[model samples]
Target: MNETLSLFGLATTPLELLSFVLSVVTVWLNIRQNHWAWLFAILSSGLYGGVFFDAKLYGDMGLQLVFITVSVWGWYQWLHGDDTHERLPVTQLTARGRAVAALAWLGAFAVLAWFLRSFTDTDVPYADGFLTAGSLVGQVLLSRKRLENWHVWIAVDVLYVGLYLHKGLLLTAVLYAMFVVMAAIGLRAWRRSMGQHGQASATMVLK
Candidate 1:
């Protein structure tokens, strides 16, 4: 632990500090249902993408590229994808959607695990695969305004905290810890927004 702390240097560097600040803002914006959240997501992902590459977390590095693309898609979806001419509302996933998501997660886990084991010198292939798959699902769900995305993030972030710590990425471990708390807050806030939307819809129907 002492050695790890020395490596990250207590987050004193400008890039480290900036990444932390951007992550906080990204979580806040996500809670608020703000489209600008994608912008911050992109920025945070780009910074951490480089960090992951430097650490030789190639799966995570590739995931960041996917995140950048998803951020762009999410930005567009939040702005104009809804039929009501409003930002996409927070909503639960359909049963079919959940089933599909599960299948996707399984498939991704298999593929990523095999790829990591064969192509890289990673020590924890299964853990990397699990987190990578979960993160992909969470990101996709988030892009579509699915409230369960936060739940996925909460789970993934908890695992990520330990993973980063094991990998000697103390700063990233700290960030994942923050992510867990922020995901809980985001879940509550988004649920509240969804409830508000439900009430509004009911009122409109009665009118």
Candidate 2:
């Protein structure tokens, strides 16, 4: 056990430490509804992208590249997507939207799993595909200011904690543990903001 732990530590090294720190900052910025959160997220994702490649988590490594592009889109959306120059409003997904998102998740998972199983020696192809697909959905929803994004994040992040631990990546496991807590906080905060926005919209309608 000790030897396994030491091996994981060697994999982490100093760059992973920097990635961990940046990830924390990214989550903090996200909680504050800052557009710059995406910038930090991009940096953190870029660092971890390489780390996952080394760890043979090919799906996650590829997801980080997608995250970079999404981060740019997110930054733009948060800044200019709203009409009043305000930060993007937190809103829940509609029923139709939820249905569509579910379909996307399923499709992505199936395709990714097949590709990974065929092309890579990944040990847990389905698990990796599922988490990666779910995370992609969460990131897209988050970029669009969807309140339900945190729920998806909380679920997948919990799974990731166990997955990383099983893979013997202790530090990455710890990072996901922190992500779980942050996701909870983000859910509460976004829900509160959504309530406030709803009330304000109601007031405007009355006027």
Candidate 3:
């Protein structure tokens, strides 16, 4: 599966190509608020773990394992995380929640970067750690149906493009570039969903 082939004039493997397709589908379903996205997320993350390992990106390889675990929790959350055990609704974080998330990202970055730098021979430990931390924040926010998850994804995906290119993963770099655009679309879509949820809540109160 790792055998190299030319696609779009760039060298890539079947494993990476498969992961790319699954990841795209995963994000598209996520934008639509479909629970099945988590299933695809798990598959893509597992595949990408092998791909990243081959590239010697230990941080990202480790992150793919985390993603697999989180995807399972995220699947359950999407199905029954809301009050009364219904599907979760789109919602924004409170001010304090946002502050906490930001702090968590920074703190995770510190620990991950230090560990990667000291323990791993990977050349881009800092970048890997930083992006890995950001992705974890985004994934948690997404699992809870938070509206700001798209914002975090936008930032992380943008940086991921450059990182993948530096690692000579041309197809994955293009995938992240596409993710940036899809994340913007997701932001707009979720904002509309949040507005609808708010209206529904107000109606229930009025009733």
Candidate 4:
């Protein structure tokens, strides 16, 4: 299924086209806060792993494996990760939590960049490593229903567009561009969800 075809004047393989479609669906479900998103995330990540491997983007290829593993944990977290074992609600990270997340992203980027540069023949090790690290952080936050996950996604997706284009993966670049807009919509939607949850809690307390 790796046959190349001209999709909207851009050459892409069947594998990439399939991956793009599944990824879009995955993000759409994520915006809706549907648990089913994790399944699609797993599927798309598996497919994209192969796509990135062919492109020699070793960091991204490795990231797909990570994504597959995380998706399973994320799926369970969405279903039963709350303190009370309830369905998780959209929430923002505290200032300290945010600081820790930032540190984690930076540390992961440093280590991944060094590893990719030292061990892979990929041409854009730094960009690949940086975006890969940010994606991991974003995925973790998203798994926990954190509102700020969209912010990480927005930043990473924008950079990924350029990275994919440079690697001649035109279709994947378009996918990342679309992800930027979808991530913005997800941010707004999740914020509204958090506000509604807050109002509901306040009502219960007042009653």
lDDT of each: 0.85, 0.89, 0.96, 0.97
Candidate 4 residue-wise lDDT, 67-121, digit = tens: 9999999999999999999999999999999999999999999999999999889
Candidate 2, after superposition: displacement of residue 93 in Å? 0.6
- The C-alpha local distance difference test score for the whole of candidate 3 amounts to 0.96
Give per-model TM-scores.
Answer: 0.91, 0.92, 0.98, 0.99
Segments in model 3 whose C-alpha atoms lie over 4 Å from true places: none
Q: Who is ahead in lDDT, 1 or 4?
A: 4
Backbone clash count for every predicted candidate, in the order shown? 0, 0, 0, 0
| Candidate 2 residue 71 C-alpha distance from true site, Å | 0.3
RMSD of 4: 0.6
CA shift at 166, candidate 3, in angstroms?
0.4
Query: How would the candidate models be sorted by TM-score, starting from the highest?
Result: 4, 3, 2, 1
Error of 3 at 50 (Å): 0.4
Candidate 3 lowest-lDDT run of ten: 82-91
The superposed Cα distance between candidate 1 and the true structure at residue 132, in angstroms, equals 0.9
lDDT, candidate 1, 1-207, per-residue tens: 111224345533455556667988998898888889999999988887777766678888889899999999989999987897677888899999999988998899999999999999888888988899999999999998999899899999999999988876767788889989999999999999999999999999999
Candidate 4 backbone collisions, by pair: none
